[model samples]
Target: MSGNWTEQRIPDQRGRIAIVTGGNTGLGFETARMLAGHGATVVLAVRDVEKGRQAAARITGNTAVQLLDLTSLDSIRTAAADLRAAYPRIDLLINNAGVMYTPKLTTADGFELQFGTNHLGHFALTGLLLESLLPVPGSRVVTVSSTAHRINAAIHFDDLLWQRSYSRSGAYGQSKLANLMFTYELQRRLAYHGSTIAVAAHPGVSNTELARNLPGWMRMIVTGLAPLITQKAAIGALPTLRAATDPSILGGEFYGPDGWGEMRGYPKLVTSSAASHDQKIQQQLWAVSEELTGVTFPVK
Candidate 1:
């Protein structure tokens, strides 16, 4: 066995608690299910409460769905506050909610749809829930990003909201790249604070709801070729689960598929693109995120 996910087994997560945003369907739901099955109390945070209930009902084990609309900062804050008051500790936070290609849409806060939901929302959620995370000694945050990041010129500070120009593909790429930058920067911050949390993970070319914002033809084409061209959502969740639960994982290192070209397979330590490691860009993004979201991480 390769000692990656193939040889790996789900550890004892009996006492763990997790929040998985957009977890009512697709990769998020699968990841939530896997974690719950391994004995973690999983919270499936979704935009639709009724639909979330329906989705959680399909899973064989225990799961709870809570209303969480990432585009709204108010919703994110409220959810985090409520969860913090309820759960004793949050063992894992899977910032998995995101939007992919859309014609041109803006969030409630007037940010680009892809960039807003994918990067900014998760960024804010992590910041808001920082208190809950620190209480859990072995807590970890596993953020999901895509290979689309390779082409991304991250954080066009001049046109942060894509007001001057916008392309669905470009916006999606930039958002995914932001995820990587946030992940790395978060690990650095955790180390600086002497905290016991680790953060990492990537899912390359998985069949998921991320493309719900794409054109009809694009969605259909991708759906048609999903089984052949991409890995299933179950397999895609492995890397994220490993990062969240595995004891051997170290902070700042990313995990992705081990198959050819990273399209599909079990989880393994994978390298991120050079641009994902740009410290200056990470710092700039972190600062900008705090300003835009109005929620600075209260870390010393």
Candidate 2:
């Protein structure tokens, strides 16, 4: 347990099986590479099989790929079934794929694009795959959230799907906030099980393609600030790597950069927004999620 955590500290991962969504590029690619390099059997659960294969080929250890488009429930179910049949046990499930600040749109299931892909997608996938992890000691579910969760974020129970109106940033914020709430609530449910745990991490302001949706003017601003504010993707993936492998991590803890405003630095145990810690909202969101996706957890 040090003040600064980096990829070098990732414990030996031999014999482990890790599934990282969006593993083909950016932060996800970096995460998959490190895990595979450490001897873990890494599955690049990406939407593009060709890209996944290309990414896997670049890595040095055992690796595989499964097509999963988080925007579609059918895709999630199929991918989950395929993964379950392929691996009897899952040591780690990294819900790292997400869309950010896209124009007002909905997923194949008709949920808001960001909410559907970021929160509900991971939610359903985790529920379907929980059985494989529950029996495996030290198993972890690490969801990648974002610092944007604190900006203009609210659960919007009455308008969870963003049917009324849409602000791309607000929607993205809600999704990221849901990511944290889901982690905390999931950890609570798994506490009695004693084998599986849920944790969350954010990459801070990393230079990644996840920001491609930024508006033209905003992109310019970001590009101008990049030198001073953003870190590389490899560095951005550290918090997630730590959250996934740090043996000292407990259920419900969040990790992020240790620098000012958590923008860029080595990984460290970090706190999320106070709103993300709301128990009632978390439970409510969970119920709504299950009702919407029809995917219930194996745990109580």
Error of 1 at 135 (Å): 2.3
Per-candidate Cα lDDT values, in order, are 0.84, 0.94
lDDT per residue as tens, model 2, 19-56: 99999999999999999988899999999999999999
| Cα-lDDT of candidate 1 | 0.84
Q: After superposition, how far is residue 131 of candidate 2 from its true place, in Å?
A: 0.3
Distance from true location, Cα of 255 in model 2, Å: 0.3
Model 1 alpha-carbon miss at residue 245, Å: 1.1
lDDT of 1 by residue, 266-297 (tens): 88889888888999999999999889899888
User: In model 2, where do residues sit more than 4 Å from their true spots?
Assistant: 1-3
Candidate 1: where are CA atoms >4 Å away?
Answer: 1-8, 216-225
